[model samples]
Target: MKIVEQSGKETGQGRGRALWAAVAVIAIAAAGVVGGKIALKSKVNELVAERGGKAGAVEVDFLGRIHLRDVTLPLGGRSNARIAAIDGRPKILFLNGTLEMTGLDIELPTARILVPHASVEDANLDPATLTELISRKSAAPLAKRIDRFAAKRVSATEVAITQAIAGSEQKTVYRQVNLTDIANGSVARYSADGASFEFAMAIPDGAGGSKQEVMTGSIGQMTGQDFDAAYMARLYTEKAGPDDKEPRPLYGPLSAKAIAFSNGQARFAYDEMRSSGFSMRMPAEPLLETLEKLTSVTNPEELEPEERRAFFGRLLSLADIIGKGDMEMLGLKIDAPAKAGEAEGEKVKLAVDRMALQLDGRRLDAALHGVSMGEGGDYVKFSEASMTGFSWDSTLEALKKMAGLDEQQLETFPFTTLLPEFGTFRVAGIDVNLPNPDTGADSTGTEGYADETGETDALAAEGLMPDAEQEAGADQQTNQPVTSMEKPAAAVPERIRFTLKNYELALTKPFNGIPTDIRFSYEDLSVPVPAKAQDETSVQLRKLGFDELVVSSNIQAAWDEPSQNLAIKDISVSGKDVGSFSVSGLMGGFTKDFFSGDPAMAQVALLGLTAREMKLEIEDKGGMAKGIKFYADQNGMTEDQARGMLTMMAAAVLQQLAADQPKLQGPVDALSRFIAKPGTFTLTVRSKAETGIGAFDLIAASENPMLLLDKVDLEATAQ
Candidate 1:
């Protein structure tokens, strides 16, 4: 549009001058009108393109010094509403102008249902009167309205703030909204950090009010319903949905699909990561509550009686939850408290601490110790996990949570209880003080005691002997007073007394799941059995009162998962170490005991069978005297069948002895001599098993003869 220009001063009413004046005024007015529309439209498009977002037909109208009359952003209409107001004034200097709209209605029906009410403080169009563009252009009103409406439509679905500068007066709220009907929604807000652009996220935690949820994701991604950029891009542009404006279900089920975050810390990579495990240390209180739920522990008062057992077990397992290699990672270190007199030795060093993880193609390996391993072929594998001096107590605390116990339960269940369950005696060395069976240096140590009773001694079976009575009487007489006693109390005299010879035992293994190959051995391990009938002085009684330990060869049988079998092994032991091995950690049960009543039901369960129910068979072939054999006929059988059938129940033999001697009735007090003392039977068997706990094996006879097997440390060793 060509226009003429003229100053009011050189004026003449001539046709040309009049025409020039009129042209100038009209041209300036027209420029003002067109410029306003062009500028506003340009800003809106810039916003959408810059953010890589989508929108619909936009219209903005203005009036007064700084008031907006109508602004129509394409918000999906809630039954059709209209542009409300825009009233922020651009600090215009001189010229006064207004473009007032008399009527306005038509809510946005696309990105959001924005009923915009905006007021620019002072809007003017004069060249010299440009106002401060506070918002660049106000879109908050439209967004806020859209958000409010969205919340009502769906309880689960709403515009969540992908990023927000909260805790401030001028907090910017960035949100993501999904408009299935509109075929699109916006990644909206003034998120300078591009946080709102995240397509996927994982919230660490969420609670009822003021939930502090961390949105972890990446930029330029579309999250929710498995939808991403490529998918949403097509859907939005094509406007494909059940109707023209709605996004089709085909485009939904959208997920961020491994979105990126923090520049490059996170990036979308085809949803390959099955799981990216991350550990978070929460407040200790919450962790305690978690444990309390699993067991019956609530308070300290209830710990010893009920919660003491399971608490320790759960704690041990929980210690493993860091995946066996993260003690250092968790910044846990074991610090032994300084003893009163002892100075610390060289600091203990950590040997191995390694943790490895693999998900999809991503791998995270960390260790405080050197390690080597083959590459993960199909799945990730970690080896060599050892955390030295880890906080046993902290681990127990964690176990409570892992065990699903509440916080209160854990408080009662401390980690100390596990030590007692391991059944380690404070004393180790003791010597057996009995006369030697052999005259020479007592090389084989029959000197330790009577050692064994030869089955041929018929008089020994009568249980009457002056020597036995002398030993019993001597032990009962006070050593210091040197008094002769005509009579001792019947009960007191009945209890046998065996002076403790030095015995030794030391154990080095974890409590609970102590390694099976683990061994507890000592050079001077000695334990006296019931010497005389004095039960009060007997070691067995003392043991029973405490650890309830039994003496015998333990026929141990267990399953080895790796070998896939019922493995057979044996442990020969007799000790005065009696203590309970409960699965509970002292602190575990206390939490539930108070709140939920009684949780003692989950005790150590039943004490398993000991070796007593276990038995052994020995087979050895011997030819009878040739002359006697020629005259008499014993059941004649081949060596092979004889060997095979020789297998017989040891219990049956014990029963036979009990039947023969009526006095040997109740429980068959120790094996008696009446049962046929095994004659030369060599036993060949693949297994040794016990019927119950606290019972094991005792070899009554040897292969050469029915002679007693003493010092049967007939040792077995690993091949």
Candidate 2:
């Protein structure tokens, strides 16, 4: 009985002690849980504050993962203009080094965006530590800091946006925006699908009224990839070391499909657009210096006028970024009414299968294929056209050096002022169709244009002959010329005078330069000559029935003072169906002192000096003989009559030459024989002595015209 009583007492005491121990452990664990929650809440609040958001606006919910709701972000220190109702479900995977945010939503009164899912991979930096790194002052470049932050890859899928402006009834909606491996990847890809945009604006019409313009468009899909953008941006924007040869190509590829735009009246549709290998070269020393100066200024307005000019000049210098790339568009079409209100006249339709442009440093090439345009109730077509070697680098460099551009002067300089200084350029296969002004009855010049020979008969009746009374009346009317009594219209000077002034300013300082050759040539150029008065020179030329006309020129000019020489190497005008002619010459004995005076006076003096030593040779080949015969035939003249007319005209010209110089009578007679048959003719003239402008005046005033030619050399040949 005594042993049983003792055992029961000990068991009860042991149970009581065990119960107390368990209670103590539970209390300690509950206190620790509360403290941990408080610390997490404090940390989240600190983070929100650092990101410029109010802690009270953020709501935290822990349902296995972290969730935030109803966060407000101030805009430009304006609490009223703020981003409202931001919500997200974010889970931090510490072991995997990732932050996955799902169902993220952002809202504003005018605009709203929702991102279904976003994830940041390789997010190894702690939030607090990242905040400190960002907040701390450092001497490193902003590019470098950004590079460090971009070490992690961020991806977002299926982002949609809707926007509505306050004063506009239009709404814009964009859907399915996806970004993958945005920061660090071989190619960071961004894409969006099914985007609709609307715009409305009022444009001023020439007459005081306003025209309302509305535009609407849709993007079926757009995809863009920046090939190693983060890396290349760091390399190009950041300062380079002495050993760096050149920055690698900073390039990307882009593609878009099914873009359609319309402005109520006209519509444009493109099936697809692609741009590949777009690149930019890092600028040179001058451009770099300008960039550095720009960075030194916190406010652009603080810069002086000169500094601003210099900055802008340097910036314009870089506008030709010297990159190479290719771009292409497919299935482009344009449709519009040909006239303002006449849909029945002709609805214009233009279509092109493909258009492409390619650039390779200092060289450009472009091509278009399957082009067709509506013309005169039918479509004019072009299979393909291309051009190449269009560049302006060297000319721009020369202008820069000649202008003596200082850093300050370059800031606001307009580089287009130098456009007039560009060198030679060439283009091929350009087809231009000038709209005919006389498309109605005037184009046919007679009723029943479709009838055979009606136009020629009408022209013959109207233009070939005139009655004696009418001719007499016309002479009497012309004898008394009617002059306008109204005050002359004041000439409005062109706005381009300012640009010309800039060019003159560049030339204020003398620059000894090399020879330059500039020419522009086009092929298959055809233009119809309209009906003209009987006195026009081209009226006779058109009667020759030439099918087409081509105009081409080649000029080589040089000025050298030390060498005491000025030369025009060659100037030629050649055509396919028309005749060809050329003039070339040289002069010597011009010194530097001759050009040291006022430019205009110097030019006059130079011309005088050149006139003393000038030598010119003029050449012609079968130029006007065929045209003359064609005209005489069209005028119903016999072959013999045409021959007689040709001979009489030749004799008259030779007689005039004889009047100028009896010493050239033999040559003049020879030239007449040369024109009698289809042959080439050449004339050479050389000055005899040093003559000034007074000599030309004397020749002009001389009653004995042949005496002037006798003072110089003249030679003519026919073969």
Per-residue lDDT of candidate 2, residues 1-719 (tens digit): 88999999999999999999999988886776566545555666666665676633444444212335445444433222222333332323443244555555566656666666666665434444344434334455544554445324566665556566545545455566655654432446767776776776664544677666677888788888776654455444643446544434555788889989877666789999899867655554434455667667776455676665555556555655556789999999988767643435556789989999987665566777777776443445556755545454545555555355556866645443343322333333334342223222222222111212223334447775455576567768888542232112222111100000000001111233222233333334443343431323435555655433445545555555556655656666665555556666666655554444345645666545444333333344445656667757877997668877888988898889778657888678768876676456677666676542243544473775544564567777777
Worst 10 residues of 1 by lDDT: 579-588
Steric overlap count per candidate: 117, 16
TM-score per candidate, chains pooled:
0.20, 0.60
Q: Choose the strongest candidate by lDDT.
A: 2
Model 2: weakest 10-residue lDDT segment is: 496-505
lDDT by residue (tens digit), candidate 1, 251-310: 222222232332122122222112222222112223334365445555543565335445
For each candidate in the order shown, give its overall lDDT on alpha carbons: 0.31, 0.55
Show where candidate 2 strays beyond 4 Å.
Answer: 1-45, 54-65, 73-142, 149-174, 182-187, 201-210, 227-250, 277-331, 339-346, 350-517, 520-524, 527-566, 574-578, 587-673, 686-719
- Deviation of model 2 at 107, angstroms: 8.4
Clashes of 2: 16
Candidate 1 structure, TM-score to reference:
0.20
